[model samples]
Target: MSVLTTKEIMDIIPHRHPFLLVDTIEELVPGVRAAGKKCVTYDEYYFRGHFPQEPVMPGVLIIEALAQVGAVCILSCEKFKGKTAYFGGINNCRFKKKVVPGDVLMLETELIKQKGPVAIARATATVDGKVAATAELTVAIG
Candidate 1:
């Protein structure tokens, strides 16, 4: 019914600082789609070593953020509340651009299919409304 702030999202997803990439979920329609934000910062732990001189958000983390958005979508469903949604797999994942500090990543995730306890979704991370990364993420309730 309402967008979830970072605090509310933290309560729903089991991710902590550094790994907690999604800063806020602006919109979520249970069992359908969700949109969120990840504000990149130079102070991030990974940035300290990701390339001291030239820090950049790793492509893998981008995919993970996307999947987490999907997870929020699934867990938003009443039945999966408080239940952990594990990443089953990622297919056709591609990084089209580099993500750096100060970039506000808009995570958009859409449910493509769901069967039993398995859910498949399409996700994308964008900066300045341009595609940064995309993938088909499979999640399972465990």
Candidate 2:
């Protein structure tokens, strides 16, 4: 069961079409953790320019997707409601595999720590149970 639909996710995050990478929130614990999904398709706008022959989902976008999931976890909390989570920094980021069309990216983020308006989360993006990307993200809620 989905914890939040695309429409509901839109209400929580400011991202819109072409940029909103998260398709559904499968699991969520406000201010703690979140698990989301993004189904990469051949029709994605990025595919047009990212690579005409062998299209692959950009690594930066994969990080962005993970960040969006972290945002949902933080912004959904009553204390942080209506606030935006900005990327303060990214650390230990590593891309392990290529994500391409027809892949369903499973994104997960766990809020590991927080100080004032700043928070840190361990994030990961996986495809078919294989790690595609991993990072420690620092976010500032404002």
Candidate 3:
């Protein structure tokens, strides 16, 4: 699949600015897998409070970004179109690096299993080819 702009991604999943962590979809395979990007900047909303002196992107938000991309991977399916994917659970999550300003975060999620409205995916977030976070995500389509 070709690259997807924020607007195009928005068409597939329901996430908005600030809360919408994905800036673009670099690669997509509808229901199979997807890779997204988020350019972390110094002006991001959470920077002010996360650390006034030295900003660091929160780990949970990184997980959320992963989820958003995973949502795109799952929700883009023909039968799941226009539906919302909610987080059923996150497992084996780990944070290996601190994501900060000027870092372009690369996120990828691959759906490993699905049964009806439930799906499971393995997700990873990276910065400059270094792993930042990884998790197994389970979501329910509604």
Q: Best-fitting candidate, measured by lDDT?
A: 2
lDDT (10s digit) by residue, model 1, range 1-142: 4399878998888998868888889889988999999889888888988888999999999999998889899999999999888999999998898899999999999999999889999999999989999999999998
Candidate 3 C-alpha lDDT tens digits along 1-142: 4489999988988888879999999998989999999999999999999998889999999999999999999988899999999999999999999999999999999999999999999999999999999999999999
Pull out the clashing pairs in model 2.
Answer: none
| TM-score of candidate 3 relative to the true fold | 0.97
Better of 2 and 3 by TM-score: 2
Using all chains and alpha carbons, the TM-scores for the candidates as numbered come to 0.96, 0.98, 0.97
lDDT of 3: 0.95
Error of 1 at 43 (Å): 0.5
lDDT of each prediction vs. the true structure? Answer: 0.90, 0.97, 0.95
Candidate with the larger TM-score of 1 and 2: 2
- Where does model 1 exceed 4 Å of error? none
lDDT of 2 by residue, 62-114 (tens): 99999999999999999888888899999999999999999999999999999
Runs in model 3 deviating more than 4 A are none
Report backbone clashes per prediction.
Answer: 0, 0, 0
Q: Residue 96 CA error for candidate 2 (Å)?
A: 0.5
Number of clashing residue pairs, candidate 2: 0
